[model samples]
Target: MSVLFFDIGATLADVSVAADGSLTFHPRPRVVEVLDSFAQVRKGIISNPGPGATARENAAAALEAAFGGRFSDEALVHWGAKDRRGIFDGAVTSAGPGAGDCVFVGEDPDERVFAREAGMRTAAHPVFTLAAVEGRPVFWARIEAPDDRSPAELEAVAKLDEVVPVHVASDRLVLAMATARGVRAVEQSGFTADLRGQVGETSAFLVRDDRPVAVPVAFAQASAAFRATAEATMRAAAAFAFVSAELSGSRPPVSSLGPGPGGVYIAAAAGVPVEDVHIPGARPGHIERLLPDPALLSRPGQARAERFVTAFAPGAPSQETVDAVRAAVTPPALRAHVARISGAGPLVDGDPLTVRSRDASSADNERVVDALAGRLHELGLEVRRHEFTWRGHRLSNVEAELAAEASDAVVLVTAHLDSTGAEGEFFDSAGRSRPYDPAVDPAPGADDDGSGTAAVMATAECLSSMVASGRTPARSVRFVLFNAEEQGLVGSKAYARAAAAAGDAIAGVLQMDMIAGFQGGTRTMEIHAGSVVPGPVAGASDALADLVAQAGPAVAPDFTVQQLTGAADPAVGRSDHASFHERGWAAVAVSENFFDDTGPATGTRQYHRPGDTLLDRDHDTDYAASIARTVAVAALTLAGL
Candidate 1:
């Protein structure tokens, strides 16, 4: 089989840093489907190692977490820099494929060029390589513009069949016109004086098109003739009973066009007879007095938002489920959980519990992990710790599993437990910063990830209570608190990799990160799904988002849920869901606004900063509770409750 060498970063996955200075490499959307589609073909990774030994080790762990055993050891190239030709040569040799039999799929133009120079075909995207390997027809064409028309017009014609535009001189149009008219004697030399002025050093291009043709003479002529043809076509389609209006000379008020019945209002203002005022494209039976619906023309985002809210109205599900979810996910409960996690409660003496450093050896990080695991165990969950070494630091993930009555199918709910401050910079009350020794400083990190961690813990408590009350679900549920996520998703990647290796049937992963802060106004929450991830996985992601959307009205009727597809912010994929997405599992992230903004009420900004404290003014636990409730409803729905 022909071997395919793939690039990792950006092309396959996106790398993000957590609050604790950990990095998480999230796979691009639909990568799982893309990889599975080529399962019959051999695949390998050709990635540049990270800068330092620690970074390199983290990259290796991330790769294993994302791809698992899908790629063999010999097929993987994660050590050396990828810019060198030696790397390409080595990758080909390791894959046991001849130079000609191998194809390199990468996102970098320079790397692709280097691969091509090494005698292997290269594609900028995996889809293109798949197309070529499947023997699909790849169209290509070249055509010149005709006289009396611009290159852009001719280019439009070329674009019809996905062809590239080649702009030749205007005289080429005459040649094409003559050729179309079957004038065999016509040549560039025979062009008239008018056509000669248009001729110059024009560019020729090679384009992609479906049709088989040496030169697209007919296509060029059609493009050049389009304007006249279009006018004629429109005139022919028009009913002659309605005369074309001439309102320009009447000096109609331009301001009348702002809104309302602009044409009729203009005619009336200009004292032109309504019957004589002809609007272009108006048919015989068209209503002259009709006004455009402002809602139709204006942005319908609000209306669409209402539809989502209605879908999640309480009436859609049983009162029993809704009550259970509500009782478990209350504002007071969430607030207390946040207080404990942030060390603002009496239990920890009000000192900031800095979970910022992702280094496993950090006392604070391990202490937080122990505390969370103890809480899960107290809630009666079968707790397990997933341990792995990343960047020479040993990391641990705390997972609590609630097995269902008879199913092995699993629903994974997760959050990153690590927090981060201003790195080394210390900020004052006014947000002014100064360098400080991290060892002596504190990063409260109450909102960045503490909110997520608390929500997951709260969810576990709620579910455990339901289970104890004899309300078991049809599928098993796992509540996982990931470590080193603030660094590079080190902990979750390890868990996902092991799950895939064990052939675990994970139904989906709902990642809660930064869900507590309320941006005020309409209390909006953002649901993110990677659009590039396709097939059942992408569908599942969308479905999960939709569930969250529908849960808004039922759980938090006062709030609005906005679903964002592949959020432009890189932070959207910087969580544990990305690891599951990399493995082709369905995952979605539930969070507060994915943008940087001053707190709507308090104007205090605490995302990933030292001021991420558990303050009621900024970090609204009520808002977080609503989000938790919505998540609970969605989880129960997915668990087949």
Candidate 2:
């Protein structure tokens, strides 16, 4: 069950005024309904600190009253600095119980940003804030309040066609207007009302075209007491919603939005003598600004072009190197070679490489393992084989080493040599396949880990050459071609177990699962730094990510570097790092950003299919090599070389 965390102030409750001009809490029922619908959901509040604990208590009380007991003392979170780390530390520690299955809600941009950083999805709310505008005070009076009206009401009264004019003094014309239209004004003041008098905001009102039909005023002496009462009464009448409906598309009309401290008036229409006509929902200064146009969806070709351009977007590996890498992976010769080797002859007739974990107990998987082992040896790494009896069948995990050393801290880089086969015979070479084939014998397994394996092999060659040139690695590096990784990180887990048992000081582990093949080289890498790693390990992970950005292809500035340091979740379990992390070690996966590309629903489909041949798409061997070099440098640095 997923847990949801909601912020109280702006999310659930709103501030309102009662009939007596007293402050009150108004809760949004729709929001509460959504919360009530979820059986697996929990709610909480996050608020900023107020004056002192007393202020906090009062705020909490208001929140609780609005939410009907959803909020508690523990649910209220406060931070001195309202920034990312501050927000995260406060929320995580207070609402720490549901970290793994939680999403946070808030209105502040900083709070939403912090929630995302803490590895939670965020929903932003539209909370109200204060806005200022310049305008004259417009008052309103209904015929219902007759004798009750005070002398201040007689001060600025105007009748239709009554020429009432006053000099603008101190930027404000204190005038009273009626709420109803066509009210007769018995002007007691000397100034007469002009029927042609303008009645819009300082700069927004269309007075020439939208002149008020009526405005009434009564003359009153300008005394200190009279001035105060008149000002207060006018302010009270200004509280109605008067927003420009045209400005607020699809929003409801208002008489006057609201008023705040400092003569901050909500937009409203001015009054003329006969009667006052107020346009609803017109906020002050709203007409001067125009809203941006709505966004349009991209055309099909445009989207493709965007993806293509972004893939090769300048930054990262040079175009020449990127092209070179592609040529190596899908070379015509290699394509022909794989076609001839598979015998289905040419992938057009063969199945896509199927990626899957060797279930060990599956008879067919063992045969495939033997064949894959032959292929590995043909490629030149010394293979280490282990076979176990499980359910009356043999399950094998093969490990091959390119370089070996003892007494040196081990840097293990590995990938599973498996595939998922799900495409059709269109991907099959010959008739040797299944319908909607999920797996086939000797699946090319190109991208699954095949690309990874080749990259590893290529990297191994680079390291081997460096070692042979009399440059012994300050730290021993072992590139293990792990079998059965596709089957739940079994091989990596087994390897991690052995390392732990042997008391091997593993400086760090970097796993590359799938790292090749996309149109136009749209390359993205997700740097995963484990949550449970010690300070040093996390620092190393972050440093390595920075190095990759600095040395590899043009990486996007917004490229993701996830620090899984707060809590463990599904993301951490989806790769080989789980095994190592389980044993209190530091491990992280560096792979293409698949999430942003394909929707999460369908995973990389070519995974275990026979069509997982190298010819499937352009491969970036240069990028692969750069990755090799980057990891090599990172390992060297991490191991103190």
Best by lDDT: 1
lDDT of 1 by residue, 523-554 (tens): 77777776332234455666668777877788
* lDDT score of residue 235 within candidate 2: 46
lDDT of 2 by residue, 1-641 (tens): 33456654334443322222232344432455455554344556555433366556665666657666554446534523344446655566665574454456553334555666676555432111000001122222111223444323432243221112111111122122221122344333322222322222211111101112222245245676566556544543442222343334443222332222112123222111100122332211111100000000001112222332233222344433333333333333333433332322522224454323233333345545555455445545555444321112224455544444553455666556544443324435665643443233445556566556555554454454544555555556656655555444545544554444345566456676666544443445555554332223344444444544553433233333333323222134446654555444456666554422223312234544566665565444434444444444444443333
Which candidate should be chosen as best, given TM-score against the real structure?
1
Which sections of candidate 2 miss by over 4 Å? 1-383, 388-393, 401-406, 422-442, 531-570, 596-605, 618-623, 636-641
Worst 10 residues of 2 by lDDT: 289-298
TM-score of each: 0.50, 0.39
Candidate 2 accuracy as TM-score: 0.39
Model 1 residue 294 CA deviation in Å: 56
Off by over 4 Å in 1: 1-315, 346-361, 427-438, 566-572, 596-604
